[model samples]
Target: MSLDRRLATPALTTLLVVLIGLVTGCARIPTDGAVRDGTTELEQASEIGFIPAGPTPGASPDAIVQGFLTNAQAGPTSAASFAAAQEYLTPAAWRAWDRYVRVLVLDGDPQLVPEDLEEGATSTTVTGSAVVVATVDERGVYTEETDPSTVPVTFALTKRADGEWRISQLENGLMITTGFFSQAFHLTRLYFPTPDLAWWVPDVRWFPRQTWRTDATSEILAGPPEWLADSTTTVIPEGTSLAIDAVTVTDDGTIDVSLTSTITQATADQRALAVAQLEATLVEGEGRDVELSDGTSPLPVPDNAVISTPQTRGDALAVSDGALYRVVGQSLVDLEDAPSLDGLDPTALATGPGDRPIVVRDGSDRILRLSGTGVPDVVMTGRDLVPPSVDRFESVWSARGNTLLVGLASGGVQTLDVDWLDTRTVRSVRVSPEGARVAIVSSGPSGRLVHVAGIQRDADSVPTGLSTPVQVGASVDQVDVAVWQEDTVLALIGAEQDGDRAVFVAGVGGQAGTGGLARVLTGVTEPTWVTASVGSGAMLVLDGDDTLHARQTSSLWPPVAEGVDLVAYPG
Candidate 1:
């Protein structure tokens, strides 16, 4: 987003009028209905020194040129303004105004000049187009500078199909120099409909159907001619809005939020409302009042409620510490409860468990380790890296001293070991009871399915190859897969399209292997992990409800009240 002062404001004003002229004039000025003639209505207008009123043959070329000039200079605000400007030039001239003058000048003040020309030349060549050259001696009313710079400028005025003459080009470096100035017009109109729209999402980021507002201050600068703005208003779609209902802190200290209405599907109005609500919440903090358009009461948040960090014992979640620890008898401490994970360094750990959990303390440049006796114990105080800004591992398993694997966005796998980092591309990672493994549901560069290798482990060695990549037979509606047992279990990981949680299962890995992966349950909220009896066919399912459900592995999901914040099965 580049902002060049010369073209930022004045250029935008000019371009806006030109676009208005083209779109408005396109319909109001009728062309030869049948493509029966080689000369366009615009072409003929160029020859007569007039632009067409509508699209009459031999219309004045001057009229078309004047139309373009007037519209470019004066922002078109109505159909009449547009129609009046279409009379002076030829198709070529109108094309130039539409293509260059309006875009390069009105949209922005462009520094246009002849790049190349020949002597004894009645015309100059710019971008392979010929144009007449001259110097402007006139000056604008603004008297800031006593003298203005004089330079040669070129403009292409040509006859249209109908013999009408119009501007063909405006020679400016704007054709090449691009940034905030050149794209301002496009960006404006692109965001014009939802002038409040900040982004068109997915292409900008990866979420779909989401439009964001840059800020409450950015407004739609230009509107179509009066008639068009009114007529086309309905073209914009509606959006969704949300209202808060209740907020509660759970016994475990995690916040439990309940809403009377959240976005199920959004309309233009609903979406706008949602954006407004979100902005208010973000700026003023939660529970802020948001007025609705329908004259309903403003949404209010519950008092005495506060948001807190999530604490879970799910296999998908890892724990780290930021405290002092003795190498031989290390004890990990929760960074939140302790003074701070001040001096610990993850990379400098002399020795500890092969898969010791660690984390970089928030807002602090220290590392903490999670150690344990009966339960996991957090050991703080470790070595620090050289560069203070380098981000250390947020979550990773150390295979051996100085060797660790790091997961990253775009399904990339990074190995930081032996004092070097090597990146290997892969699909997303799926965390399971045993460890995190790469999912096989993704495609390789060759656009073919790849096979998944089974999990492997060696005595006294850190686990490796938790699951091999596999080439699935068909395109599956799944993002990740979870492993419970060697072959008797599997679960889905990550969020899905519908927003509702679900899990699929398969029995292909074990002896009776006929039940390949299949959908076993639906509407399972926040389903992230699973624990089942080896072959008993009974399983425990965890949900976003932060509760556990014990169900027959073969039956549809049903929650059992037996739940705990932390659960463990003895090896």
Candidate 2:
């Protein structure tokens, strides 16, 4: 449906007026709240059977309460933790409690101090102050509320018939101290296919952290989330679902999944595609083999399947000096043959079909572009013009204050007809891989916060406007760069509360993986800039020392290249 070429104008006077006026509005150096508590480290859980048991049966009241809060709050997430938490509560209390009511996170464990609940009775309250960074609603909606009001979490006790003290009543919902979320819930993803079928798309989902090979597989079988409804496709047959609730991982780390008998009715190609989906989702299943439990068909992943993931080494491109280069490991291979970038000095770049999308500085300081096709003519002007992001529709989008300027491959310039433009300033913008969502750092009454908005494009892939904007979390104050590391996650490089530089990643419509903590990329601090591709394995960053580094999981960011000014990747 793309027409291949779009026309744009060379007007700078109008764009400059808006930029100068907004510069003096309010100068708050961008800073994310917290994440430095070692929450950024990635830890994978391989044993689902492990559970933190409570303190001994005859422990003191204060010890019993603290131990119960710690032992019972971990994963397999909220879904199954209730059954495990019953050990800490009386049988009657467990049955009447609602585990999903709300998650009350304390900065540290609840402090147990003697307080008078009744004139003649003794009570215990928080011994140490507690602060809640965020809250997850019943429907799993995550809200970043750094300073939510707190209520004392008190535990009541009683003596049973056997004369052993047990907790009779306690707060509902799962509870964990500030830094234990990663151990309680695995920040996992479900894979879906892009409309073009050339790339894979990952939709973020949180499962109770455990050896949950079945949790990841079942969610993938349920298909993509509603926000991604029309943007992505699933390979599983239309009605096919997981046939077994418990699939075991062999000692050798191979996963054999059993699908509903309905899979027998799928076509040869559908079956092959289904297996590809299985292979991608279960790659984190701590296993090597993803075979149909029915044992009728062979796993069919083509030699070159695009299994896009956040922690991956994806196709990365960069511009060194004035020439374009594809970052192949440590070497910068020049891609000078593309006619679109001839005779121009490129200052900034973004991901597109071939990494040809660039921002050229027309004057000594101006950076502008006319994007669409391999190369389109434009009158370049201004440095405030950040690199435009190319969405899946091939339509290019750039931010100027609150306005989103769109350049459709079909033709013409259009301002996104979105309503949020009047309220928030769009700092850095990155469209989701499926082109159905936009992750951006927006400023409103609450200052700058990271938000993900849904996009609505016309038939020709031209963006009309955005709808249903959702805040990712409240961990960061201002976002310098917001780019998609995978289809579901965005790698954020910004300042921390004290103005220290950090990198935080978040899912499109869920809690940050580290439970609202800013997951910092350890080795490199104050990176010059950060870049990531949609189907990438690693997040490439340029440190303040001019050293290029790549970070994936816990390993230190190994240097990739040197003398690199700006890094870029495919859209």
Candidate 3:
């Protein structure tokens, strides 16, 4: 990415023979005989290094250039491998190259085009064009830039005393070509403390698998990224950090997280937050426990603390005939007689996250909450308001033509200043379960696009701004967003290529379109609404006829409910 003039082409003819110095490398080749039963040879080999190979002495300029690029592998797991890469560079140029700055990951083989060599010139230009898929920085931060990146690399060369080509001048950092980014890095979610300190916001980050466990915990200690800086914080003591360099997960699945003594004498709430952060960041499989220590005593995660998870889910709750119903075994059981009932006219229901039904009263724009007591208590009261979308932080977020209102579960309202959504006509907003992201389905000059962003919150979990907005399905015309599948499944009501209304799934953070959906259910003419349960993985759709059909991961879906208009699931 650095295009400084000093890095442009200069000289290299005399050293052509040196880059031709392909050194002999040693390796125990893995054959069928090396693998017996369940044992594999690769399992025993260190994944972070090479045996140190270089282009042979007789190789051409293009081959040496390709070899230098494809073989240099300095990154999160192998920052020291650049030493081996130094074998290809002249001693002076190697000393000047800063390998820790940025690592460019290319898509496929780099096209090496040699320019017309000048008469009696030692150096000529070689223009390289390679698609850049992503880049990893020194901090281990990665960004996927799938645009094709082309760079004119200058390789000044000299014939060393041994009479061979050695790269005398080159740019800093390693250039990893070929589609190797996926193999070197993995999608990892680093947990950051939400405003309430009762839950965590999953900031999806990428880490090299070789150093993932260690780097993951360190990332947590470093706190949330810039987008989440306002909405999330660290519960670890202010000065506390990882005393050790790495977090070790034993073969038995026990995670040992060691921190400094700053947390040893911390408050009960602080200690509990520390444990929650560690467990969420370290534990991988079910029932695998996390052990935190300050290098002295074993500290366990507190049992009294509550991690925010919605108890009353939207998929299980339904409404019909001006009455409330809980769906059980495909039956709509009335809940009007449950508790302290009164005059409750449900006009519009807010979906996602809550232990009760949050609806806009028939004649009032005020939001009403009916839970344990069943007595309708006004939570958010205002005029000319739209139905609220219950966010994961136990807060309600509603936007009336870009004028957004965010109310907490406690009892207060904060109208945030969001000028970004003004250009587009805001239709509906749904927050993710992590309470850090907001999924908005809005219409603009380009038609309806799905935008997902981080919900920046104050210390009290009040909405401030929606940051890092990325329009999902930008190329697809989406009508409405049904629900989110935790971090993966994204359900939307859109038209298929043949012009038939259908439900589509774009697996967020992964694949796209029907390729991400488990089964294709088409011919739902004029499909309007969709919802999927986070707990059950059950998906339901409502067509123009108001008929409802259910779909899980399987192809077959029985009619689950009828006479239902609006539907949703917990965020």
Backbone clashes for every candidate come to 94, 18, 14
Give the least accurate 10-residue stretch of model 2, judged by summed lDDT: 1-10
Alpha carbon deviation, residue 409, candidate 1 (Å): 28
Clash tally for model 3: 14
By TM-score, the better pick of 1 and 3 is: 3
Kindly give the stretch of ten consecutive residues in candidate 3 with the minimal lDDT sum.
Answer: 32-41
State which candidate has the highest TM-score.
2
lDDT of 2 by residue, 20-61 (tens): 111222222212344432313223323223334544766555
Write model 1 residue lDDT over 1-571, tens digit each, in one string: 1111223343233332212112111122121121011111221111001122333354343333333444433222233434544444344444445322212221112334333434433333222221211111111000111112233444555555544445556542212111122121211111112122221100000000011122111111121222123111221123322223223233554332222232333354544544343332222334433223222333333232122111112121212333432211112223233223344333322111132243332222233333442122232222322101001122332221223343321223345332111222223222222222222333233432222333233332233333323232221244343433322234444333454445655322111111121233443566755543333344455666546555543444555432323221110
Candidate ordering by TM-score (highest first)? 2, 3, 1
Model 1 lDDT-worst window of ten: 201-210
For all predicted structures, in order, the TM-scores are 0.25, 0.72, 0.68
Which lDDT tens digits does candidate 3 get at residues 1-571? Answer: 1111111212111112112222223233222111011111122222223344565785545555655664464333454444545667778887898864776665444567755655555554456665554566765655444234666556656555665556777777656532234434555666776666556666555566568877878777777777667767777766777778888877988888888888776777777776777777667679776778887577755655566532225544555555556555555677545433356556556644544444443444677766666566677766645546677566777666566777677778777666667777666676776677777777777677776677776656667777766445433445555456545446677655556666665433423211111223443456777666654566666767666666643344556667875545554
Count: clashes, candidate 1: 94
Candidate 1 Cα errors over 4 Å, as ranges: 1-451, 454-468, 472-475, 485-488, 494-500, 507-517, 522-526, 561-571
